[model samples]
Target: MLKDLAIIDYEFRQILLAVTIDIEHFAKIQLLDKLEQRGEDGYSIVSSFLESNDRCNKDGSVSNYVKTEIDRGKSGCYTNDLVARYPSYDYPVWEFMELIPFGTFNQFVQFVAGKYSDKKLRNSFYRLQSVKSLRNACGHNNCILDDMKSGRPSYQVSYDVKNALRAAGFSETTLKTKMSNERLQQISTALYLHHSSASDGVVAAKGDQLRYIVKRMYRNIEYYEKNDVVKSSFSFFKQVIDAWYFNDD
Candidate 1:
């Protein structure tokens, strides 16, 4: 579980970072137009948003949080390569994207997506909330399989995610039943996003890692045979892995 959780977190970060960088590069003109409409400068959207006081942090403003991250980056306590790459007190979108926590990156994604009014990007931001929740749970060493009941989720699962699951051979009844469980829904959503967004090389590497985990999972399968909830959940996730990562189609 630990290995799988770590890989999921790492892959999600890579996927989100790649998407954000693509948006910064490919949508520069559209972003500039949107900024101009709001009377914000094109030089630094991050700076303008920080100045607006739109979002507040517990410590101070969002900018304070950003400054703290930058200071941490420069403190030489982080990875040597990361510290070496730290900007000299001036964080561009790209630099900040690398330095900030996953939760902060999610907020940044929402900010940029909202500014551009892109439906697809906005949907991605919503989907990422689940991934973020799972990532935080993993970071805190929470028991991932302790609660497996259905019928209570804080948010609706994305339609795209459901479609992907369906394509992976999940029945309509199964979707409605299993996805009602928040944790399962979040896990499936994260897997869907990673499969759809990551580069082929990344997908292949992670798939191999997941397969090894799944093999380990079944090694003690007899222990969970009587526990329908745990057993079914494992089976369901294995199907997802096979379809999304190993399928030729």
Candidate 2:
């Protein structure tokens, strides 16, 4: 029973991680919808605005707008400034795209709520925030990834586990099981963080920095479902990607 319970935690951690991405696809479709809604004339406006800067400003600097805003004293866009600051970078570095749609954290939250009427994007944001705090605790808490090998149970996930359960409208004590893939849950949450980050197409498109973080999840599910680890370990993600890829079919 204990093993089964642990496994359930492990499994749902992965599942929660996976389901949370509903917001991502939500964001992407929102983006595309926003773009198409803007249409050619809208794109021309974005383009003309950029014409004032370097020619290939494909990074989307849109200096004309920035300068106009700067003159009015409304200038703080995170993209260019954070790279210069070596310390105390409070502006969610990963959330770099704030210059555009969902222009700020509050706006992003509002976007989620408006775009997704039923899901309580605000609650998810807080849950994600709680998970993020737990992640910080996990990442910075004395048990660095190096120490987890000692196989001791520490406060690695106490708060996060409770908050995540509450987010799911469930009980906080539900996290006591060892069978769960907390890592995957963390991974999924990490992915959400990465997506919600302030950065953009230039960075996120780089590769699996995001995926690698989440991959540690699904350890138990992997063990039971495989002759090898990799396949079962990320099976949840595999199914998701596959379905997404062929979704149009």
Whole-model Cα lDDT of every candidate shown, in order = 0.66, 0.38
Whole-structure CA lDDT of model 2: 0.38
Candidate 1's residue-wise lDDT over 62-144, tens digit each? 54565565566665665335646645434455445556666666676678777778687688778777877776666565666
The TM-scores, one per candidate, come to: 0.74, 0.27
Worst 10 residues of 2 by lDDT: 142-151
* Candidate 2 all-Cα RMSD: 14.2
Q: What are the per-residue Cα lDDT tens digits for candidate 2 across 46-70?
A: 3333333323357865334433332
In model 2, the Cα lDDT at residue 52 comes to 34
Off by over 4 Å in 1: 1-42, 54-63, 79-90, 247-249
